[model samples]
Target: MLVLNGPDGKFVVDTFVAPAWPRLKEALDGLGNAPVKCVIDTHWHFDHTDNNTRLHAAGATVLAHENTKKRMSEPHDLPVLYRGTDGALAGLHFDPSPVEALPQQTFFDTCKLQANGESLVLQHVAPAHTDTDIHVHFENANVIQMGDLFFNWMYPYIDPSTGGKITGMIAAANKILSLAGNDTKIVAGHGPLGNKADLMEFRDMLVTSCDRVERLKSAGKSAQEVVAEKPFADLDPIWGNGIINSEQWVQVVYLTL
Candidate 1:
């Protein structure tokens, strides 16, 4: 977890999770006895928000998109899949947390937060990542914490079942571009950090992928065909190394579009 101290002396803690909680607390301790005032979660993914209980208990208010609140408060069935690794012995199971607490405040379009004299802009940019993904902009500091919208190196995961769309993905990227300049620091949900140029590249990739998927759809191509068709071959070398791959991406694009 990297702690960046804002101009107002407030610390913007990043990547607060299970494995990193001890380290995060240590970092906070290093900042003296100043109690954490607020904690702005980029999104409601368990990895990013499971520690919300602890933070809230420590006097920090948790914030997230309206959709994130809804999703987190709903019942979820665990996912179990068998890996064809030579036998039935290889498999994976995922058990998500049951509906619990939710964000007290949620906005459909945009919401701004002022803390410790620092201004933070939270904007909903969804149908691009999840049903309610948002971007946190530290306006004065010229830094944005883009939840899952901008994955620096890995292929972005588009949750199709939750209204995620390829077109919306591009629009979300453009929205971020409008809010930031060339030198603005971009903290991605995963992977390395980036800037405006990186954002443009991500936007362009989404646009190109959208165009490809649309074309394929118009050609009466099936989902299988779309997956088999590697329309994003150009981006494979740069952003295709992850659990999200060209085939899965194409399937999502085709399905969503």
Candidate 2:
């Protein structure tokens, strides 16, 4: 999550979760008691949007890509295909968000916001982590909040059910790289803050893994077969420690393909 203190008031990039509301509220209060004028949702995922209701109630206008509003406005079950604690394939469910938690204002390609005496460029990327992903670029600050588009060192969860795709993920990373300079601070959806180099590494990992998985699938390998082969063995030690493990990452890529 990122907070921008501009001339007008405070603008938040993404809300972490519902449980983190008190801490978030405190943080906002610490900012000289500025009102939250705007709250932006990078995507429709609960992790990034759970605090919408509270923030909106506090006089903030929620902004997000149209696709995000669509997803949050309805009941949907997000897929969770991963190895269980007992080594069995497992799945999970996600209910729809409340109406109060949904975005009130949305944009298509891009939207510009003038706040705190600076310009915020919110650009909607193609279906990447989710169809609703958007990059928040603070022009004067040279900081970019990449939502879930950049997972830092981990394998990203591509929600194909909501229009996420491996190729789109690559494209989204490239889009950030194109706009970023060496000094730009990148705020990832997860993990520590990063820079251009870290973003590059993430993009490369996605491309390399996607290529390997595609090759194996082309050779008639099933998702489980591809997982058993450990196609991303070289990258696992470095990028598989986060929420998404090797097998889970392979499954997501395969299912999207």
Candidate 3:
């Protein structure tokens, strides 16, 4: 977990991967044991929400999009550490479970909250990365926790299984661009912090890469052919790494476009 002490209060971003109890402790520790009145998750991913129970136990109100709470409530494939019972969580786990309990505060479209004097805006851009993906904007701090919408120096994963389409990913980037300005600092679900320029580049890469895949698909090329062609030949070397490789990206774009 990473800690950012804002003017109003403290922010413990990026929790554990499996949503364990200890990870919650780590997040609290990062805040210097400060009373966390509010908790904002970039998205509903385990790494970010695994500690929700612990934070809620400490009087911290967890905030997320309505869709996020609905998804978390369902029986999905969350790991044993995060799940209440056994048997693979299955895809339905995307919704809430009895033990998980949905986020207390839910917002659709856009909503803003003020705490310790800082104003934070939460927006729903789900079905972009996943059905529940949301972006948190720290207006006063000039920083934004982009959940999975923006990944710097790494491949951005668009989970097709959860309705994550490349076109939606492009829309997410555009939404970020709309909110971000020259001096805005951006924090992705993964990777290092960056500025608006970096985000613009990231968006461009996705647009161009998806365009390449669309062209290939129109030509009636097979998925293997598209992968072999390496359509992202002119893209940054790092854009094809992590879980979303060039091949996988081609597949997603083909399905989405």
Candidate 4:
């Protein structure tokens, strides 16, 4: 999450996972009594928006892309593929988020806010990570919070069920790179903070991996065959160590393609 403090007040980006709201509140309390004027959700994912209710209840006006608000307002199940007790791939489900946690303020392509003496720009990057994904740029601070559109050093999870795609992910990364410079600090959705170079590397990785997977698929290879071929073997050591493992990453990309 990105928090900016200036003359106006305090502004927070992304509420983090649901279970961590209390800890977030405690940390916020320690920051004195600066009122939270706004809370922005980069997307509708539970991990990014679960604390909306608490923050909103505390008087923060929650804002997000229109798609995010719509997604959060309904019941949508997330698909989870994992190895079962028999060591075979199995599927699991993630229930929809609570309606109270939905964002009240929604925008289409872009939204701008002036707070804490900073200019905050939220720009939508569609069909990447999720349909509701957005990039939050604190212009005065030279920091950009790239919601789930960037995964830093890890293989990103693409939710096709929500309009996420490998190609769109690459496009989003490129868009961020275009907006950033050498000195800009980038706050990724997960993993460590990064800069333009890191984003470039991530974009390259996505392109190469997608190309490899596409080639295999074009040759009439099955998803299991593509996985066996280890299309992203070279990248697994560095980017595959995050929440999305190598095998799971392969499956998602292959299925999406």
* Top candidate by TM-score: 2
Worst 10 residues of 3 by lDDT: 81-90
Question: TM-score of predicted model 1?
Answer: 0.84
What's the lDDT for all of these models? 0.69, 0.88, 0.69, 0.84
- lDDT string for model 4 (156-209, tens) is 888877888889999998888888999999999998999999999999989988
Against the true structure, whose lDDT is highest?
A: 2
lDDT of 2 by residue, 50-134 (tens): 9999999989999999999999877776666656343533354677788888899999999998888789999998788888999
lDDT of candidate 3 over 148-219, digit per residue (tens):
888887767666555677788889889889889999988877778888998888898888878888888889
Off by over 4 Å in 4: 81-92
What are the per-model C-alpha RMSD values against the true structure?
3.8, 1.5, 5.8, 2.0
Angstrom error of the Cα, residue 199, model 4: value is: 0.8
Per-residue error (Å), model 2, residue 255:
1.4
How high a TM-score does candidate 3 get? 0.82
Residue pairs whose backbone atoms clash in candidate 2 = 6-116, 7-116
What's the residue-level lDDT of 39 in candidate 1?
62
lDDT by residue (1-257, candidate 1, tens digit) is 22434444444433456677787778777886766665666665666676666666676655677787777776543221112222221122324443333565567778877765667777787577767787888877888888778887677766654577777878888888998899999888777898999988888887888888898889998866676676888888887786566666666667667
Which structure is stronger by TM-score: 2 or 3?
2
